[model samples]
Target chain A: MENQEEHQAEGVGRPGRPGRPGSNPEAVTARIRARFGDASVRDGNAVGCESVIAERDALLPFMTFLRDDPELTFDYLADVTAVDRLKLDEAVRFAVVYQLYSYKHNRRFSVSIPVPEADPRIQSVVSVWPGANWLEREVYDMYGIVFEGHPDLRRILMPDDFGSYPLRKDYPLHGKGERDNFVF
Target chain B: MGLEDQLQENVMTTKVDAMVGWARKNSLWPMPFGTACCAIELMATLASRFDLARFGAEAIRFSPRQSDLLVVSGRVSIKMMPVLKKIYDQMPEPKWVISMGACASSGGVFNTYTLVQGVDQYIPVDVYIPGCPPRPENVIQALMKIQEKVAQAKAN
Candidate 1:
């Protein structure tokens, strides 16, 4: 499908999306600014606006709006990944990445939320995106990030009895002391 | 057909048989369900230096339909056992399988809960190339053995 047709197909998309009568990137920018205002918005080179490096409280609402928004039409959540930011700044220690695909607009947006180390609780978007079930389980297994409403959250890649979160920054990379050593 | 008909056809009377026969004779395609590092050596055997294309086995088809041989390389995991069975089931009849490397031939070093001890636990293996990781020359020799097996079957 053509790019613009996708968003219109979603419902009524923002003016910034292609082929919309009044849509422009600036207009979408205005709509975004109007919703969460100046403080919540930050730009990233990799993805688009709606990038909302959202706070923990802001996650569920923003995700809900993105799902319900006719103009933005971010109907599909493609992937969710966790990045442990322990050394970068303890202020917000982990990044929960949500990749949203707009079927109507043939466009994509990524929503990142930063969770501080003290209280690493974030709402599960599984209610919003069915596919987030496995993705959230992976994040929970690897980063130990607590998803508040996940029904069947458990360790995935590693064994159930495995003690620690392996992907976290502090987890030793030596791989359980099995490394081969060569004589100097 | 009958054994008498098969014996007479083994005689090369046509020019087409010599040219195409050389290809059908030497070029035996290998399809490996490589689940680990031993797969790298399998690729090396078909690379430019070894040049398995000369023997007409270089075309590595991913699907079982066109493949003449199945090379079960590396350690087969338990989760992967069903997938291997599915792939093996998809292959045309009269297919041969080579159990390449110790992992596929036996269990090799990864004697863990997840890995299947050997591919032969699920499917018949025609030749077993026993090594931590066999060299390309060993792969070529293994192929020659399969070819001899094919020739013997034709005689029978």
Candidate 2:
């Protein structure tokens, strides 16, 4: 018990370890590039945070590597969400974002997968991180993006019978009469 | 020949309807279907600060069968409307509903798709207290109004 408390106290105030490779964004990006080739990873630092865009086909394997690798053990999947870029006139319609954190190194990294409007499907990372279950469901719920191998992918926030994804820019602000059609 | 004049000194004479109404109005048990910010105001009304017991409505019942009045004190979302309707249907007859804020009455400022426009679209409302979250004083006034309605209900 005393040893556990000392370790927790060390975690609370200690700075990033001097020799940890995953403590910086460049090392994370370089590690991904070395494994999956330069074409599979791209710098996506437009949002002022260290982020990388990964190809949809390579997502599951890349995520597994980020978790299982000794130097880059991104063990925590903080959140899974999506951004609909329809109004921005971007070529890709949606980008599914994953916020990953490594408890061992106390570092956070972001990964995004661009999905086209016509085929908005990606491999589920639930096998790599079980906590992505509900988060992936929420992304599917709001953006209408399909996670191919998710165990139970269904609407998490919206009603089960809800027709359209409200977060999409093409959807109206006041809704399309869903609120008025109740039996009671 | 008046019935009260013919009775003994301690005896009383009144119609059954009026007597029942008086009893119901004096001891109203409220079911607080609180879902949002307005619920805080409802709690304030029931707590010692405002003392809702003075009006004889302090007995808060969670079960629909035991309550005489239902106080819907927040925004009802599209997903939550069916559950709210089921609760309303379960309530015993001769019940009253108090729409206790702008949200419950008319969706307040939330004109979005998820939120229900008004709870009255699902259940019959007896009184609507119109404020973002009506003050505890306003809640007390609405309770008094419900009591007045109970007292004035005509016999079948």
Candidate 3:
């Protein structure tokens, strides 16, 4: 346990055998493209990776690929976050995010979406990752994005009676609660 | 854990009494349950400026099993209570908890069903640090108070 400085990423401190290695993300992407012939797979602009894509119809299948692939071993869903894409007049007003972690691979990946502002609806990934329950709720609570198949979706970070998502472009963070003075 | 054992060890039966008296007094591991902005201040307290390491409390375990103090640094929700309790249950006893910031101490500005008024309703709390999101200095003060409480315990 000494010389943690020499330890690999995530530090193999937990017991019961070391985890799996990362699958070729390109291969995974290839599977996504093969599965969904009609949809466009657009790469992500986020850090650590340049090739992460959003295949509109095959997102669930892509998720399944990440989770079920023995080589990929994305067994852990670390976090789910969402952002309002309002400032940019894009196709969707909201973007729901999913962070998938593979202890075996010692690498992580993220899946995201651009939900239409009008409907603000999309299929849920909770079935794919149970941890999505809270993250999805948070997304709903913050960005008003609804997961179509979520078991139970309600306001998470915000009060039940409160209106509007605080994280949205126009939503004033200070005005949501009475902590206006604390912002300083 | 037993009275006889307490007498044999010449220590308080409560894990609280023994640790504060003789061994590992300085190394108080904190379990931070951060949900909002207050978490930032708690981090600041642990960072270089305040250096919580000075108090031998720099090791904050995310897992409750190894943690001695649970620092509820921000907002808590009714839904999150079960997870919090589950984590608390895993922690070894004679443990301490610091309810940091107004949100954790008294639900801050979230006066609604979504946010719990305080962590005490479900879990035991030792110290309450108040501020909308308490400054890092306040967190240091709270740590000092916990240290005081630990130091004043009657030896078994």
Candidate 4:
């Protein structure tokens, strides 16, 4: 126990430790709304967590601000994924989600961008977070969402020759005969 | 008349086919193509507790050319099917295949687009052992069945 206390004392002010400076959900939402205007950002209905829905056009700039700002230093890009809301019958067909973590504050934030089915394209955040390369590629492979300006964008999980995105709502539970047509 | 009746004193004789079959059945080098949980059971069978060496099949060879029996034990996905076929093709002739476990034999419960329904669609299987992951005893029984087949083949 003495060793643990000594370790904690030595580890103070480092990333991931408790009792460091942090930002609340309301503060984060207010800052984003102030910068992007109330029309571009709004509070999301995510229970027990901080989530904000940003317009497709404002995603790149918003992500940059969230990372570069001193108070909201969301430096870590935890994950990039998408949801197919076909059954929900929402105005937008897909919602690309980004999970971010601020090491200074040791808090988490979620940002989502609604994408229409006709275009199905969004600005790539790889410039701000280089780790989004594979995560964006995975989203593209599964949900067929195109990430503009992403380097070396290609299928990451499925085979290279696979035709359709399997995670799409329209895709059948069983594959469309891809498994049966092997050359061997 | 038996060959013993025709043989002279202090001499022994037997058919060449019977001798070859007996030799092949006694010493089977198995190449394990294990890919999932079934592989754990396969390891148990090879360890001292089950001791697969008792059946003269403990010479587990990694090289396809050096082995005669291919024990495919686990799920085979669509992406892995081509690779599995290549391995099976590399094995020399007079080879036999034992598809161990439900997944290897009939794709088990994973009836998905990614997983192959059965490996036999690509390769000829001589024996199919049932069970999600067959017990070590089941593997021994399958080995005995393969030996029976080998001994009876061309012995008439």
Candidate 5:
């Protein structure tokens, strides 16, 4: 117990200790809205936890600000993924979701950006978080969402020659002959 | 007459085919291609309590070239089909394959896209042990069945 106390005092083991200096999710969302203006941040709400919807064009800059701002310091990109909503009658068919965590504040939040079906393109968040590389690739591989400006983006899970995105709402549950053709 | 008769019976003989069959049936080195839960059961069969060594098949060689029996004990996915076929092809002739589980035998409950419907679709299987994960004794029974097949095989 003494050794643990010494480590905590030095800030070596527990960076995400509750008393550390950082803003809560609500403060982070308000700051983003203030800096980027109302046009950039479409909506902000607390559904189970705080979630912010950002415009597709302002995504990269907004993410950069969130990481660089000392008060926010959302330094950890927990996950990068996408949801396919083909069944819903909405203008945008895909929503790219980013889960972020602040090590200093011990808080977590989500950011979602909707992308249209015809042009399912979104700016990659690899610049802010290097760990977004494979996560973004997985999203692309599963949902067929194109992440612009991403280096070395390709299929991360499925076979390179896999015909269609299997996670889409339109894809058949059992598959459409992809598993049978490869004999060798 | 015991000592006198035993001493006189010095030139006993047997058929060549029977001797060959006995030899082949006794020494079957198994290559365990274990990939899932069934692998644990296979290990139990090889352990001291179950004693697979008694059947002369405890020599678990990993290399396909050195092994005579291929015991595939898990679900085979579509991605793994080519690799499995290649290994089966590399094995020498007079080899036998045992598809040992519900998954390998008929794809079990994973009737989906990723897994192969059955291993027998790509490779010929001699014995199909039926269980989610067959017990160690059931594995031994399968071995005995294989031995019967070896004994009955015509001499080449």
Candidate 6:
């Protein structure tokens, strides 16, 4: 019991430690191992979640595989959001995260794709998930990332004439005096 | 009891301006442009608990053309400013605006990009009710103040 308590204190758990009740982490981990190798997959630090870091070029193909493969079908595109990691001391300045879920398997996984600061552009996944339309537009509106080939790509939250992306680290919390010029 | 006798008995001496002012003050139709938590308190003021009808301003009209008083009772975001201004413009002449709450009068706690500093910058305001979410009593008092202003209006 003391040794078990020490292990808990050290924050050490066995490989493939069970996650949330409904989620079958073992199944997701096994499939990721068989397909993308162990290097591509990691325990997401968050319990009940697993992380898969996919290459930019392989993003669409991997997402397609995850959706089509019967054993690891992550059919639900829960959300598409981005994090502005400008001051986090990371090589890739932006990280676009895709939260996915498998209704059939009753499991969930998160895929994060690191994007660089310069020429931030990514392939539009609307063809794969129609729901990604507005979500991607919102990401673009906030992060200023271009989702190439996004049909009707426009600002969803901010005004069309709004210049700066509000969510970026460089943008001011009080705004850039643009809101003052608005004629009511 | 001929026409000459009836005219002397029925005629009463009163100023035309005073009569007009009396009508304006007693029959103020309010437009409640409530958008936040203050809206709930505004509703309470209108409800039986506070009974706003006693002031003769209980007729809550959503259409700006039908209302003479705009009871702005919450934070007004920048995006919402244009709409608020348009509604104010649509209100008939001699209309008064009551900014009810900290957010409405001075942007309250949300001194941020999305919120306007104060609604008065966008539209003319008559009464500024000071409170985070002013109690129903405060709303009643503001209404009384508007009634005073209406009573003092001059006829052209």
TM-scores for all candidates: the values are 0.54, 0.91, 0.48, 0.86, 0.84, 0.86
Task: Write one digit per residue (lDDT tens) for candidate 2, span B9-95.
Answer: 779877888988899998999999999999999999999999999999999999998987999999999999988888888898789
DockQ of each: 0.05, 0.73, 0.04, 0.63, 0.45, 0.55
Tens digit per residue, CA lDDT, model 5, A91-178: 7899999998877556677899989888889999998899999999999988899999999899987777777887888888677876
Q: What are the per-model numbers of colliding residue pairs?
A: 13, 0, 2, 0, 0, 0
Off by over 4 Å in 4: A1-23, B1-12, B154-156
Identify the runs in model 2 with alpha carbons over 4 angstroms from their true place.
Answer: A1-23, A46-48
Tens-digit lDDT string for candidate 6 (A67-158)? 88766667899999999988888899888888888775556678888888897998888888889999999999999999987998999987
Residue B44 lDDT in model 4? 94
- Shift of residue B56 alpha carbon in model 4, Å: 2.2
How displaced is residue A91 in candidate 5, in Å?
Answer: 2.9
Q: Candidate 4, which CAPRI tier?
A: medium
In what order do the candidates fall by DockQ, top score first?
2, 4, 6, 5, 1, 3
Global local distance difference test of model 2: 0.86
Candidate closer to the true structure by lDDT (higher is better), 5 or 6: 6
- The docking quality of candidate 4, as DockQ, is 0.63
Model 1 spans > 4 angstroms off:
A1-29, A45-50, A177-184, B1-34, B37-72, B75-137, B140-156
lDDT of 1: 0.73
Say what the interface RMSD of candidate 6 is.
1.5
TM-score of chain A of 4: 0.86
Candidate 1 C-alpha RMSD relative to the actual structure: 11.1
Per-residue C-alpha lDDT of model 4 across residues A1-184, encoded as one tens digit per residue: 4533432453322233222342234667876776778888878876655799989986778899999976568999999999999999699999999998887667678898999999999999999999999999999999999999999899998778889898999998788988788554
Cα RMSD to the true fold for all candidates = 11.1, 4.7, 15.1, 5.2, 5.6, 6.4
Candidate 4 — which pairs collide?
Answer: none
Worst 10 residues of 1 chain B by lDDT: B12-21
Segments of candidate 5 deviating more than 4 angstroms? A1-24, A43-48, B1-12
| Cα lDDT tens digits for candidate 1, A1-184 | 3644654554434334443443443444445667889787666445333354556686778888888876666788899998887787447778888888777655567677887767777899889888899999998887888898998898776555555676888877543421211111
Model 5 has an lDDT value of 0.82
How would you encode candidate 4's per-residue C-alpha lDDT over B28-145 as one tens digit per residue? 9999999999889999999999999999999999999898899999999888888888888899878899999999998899987788888999999999999989999999999999
List candidate 6 segments past 4 Å from native: A1-18, A21-26, A37-43, B1-12
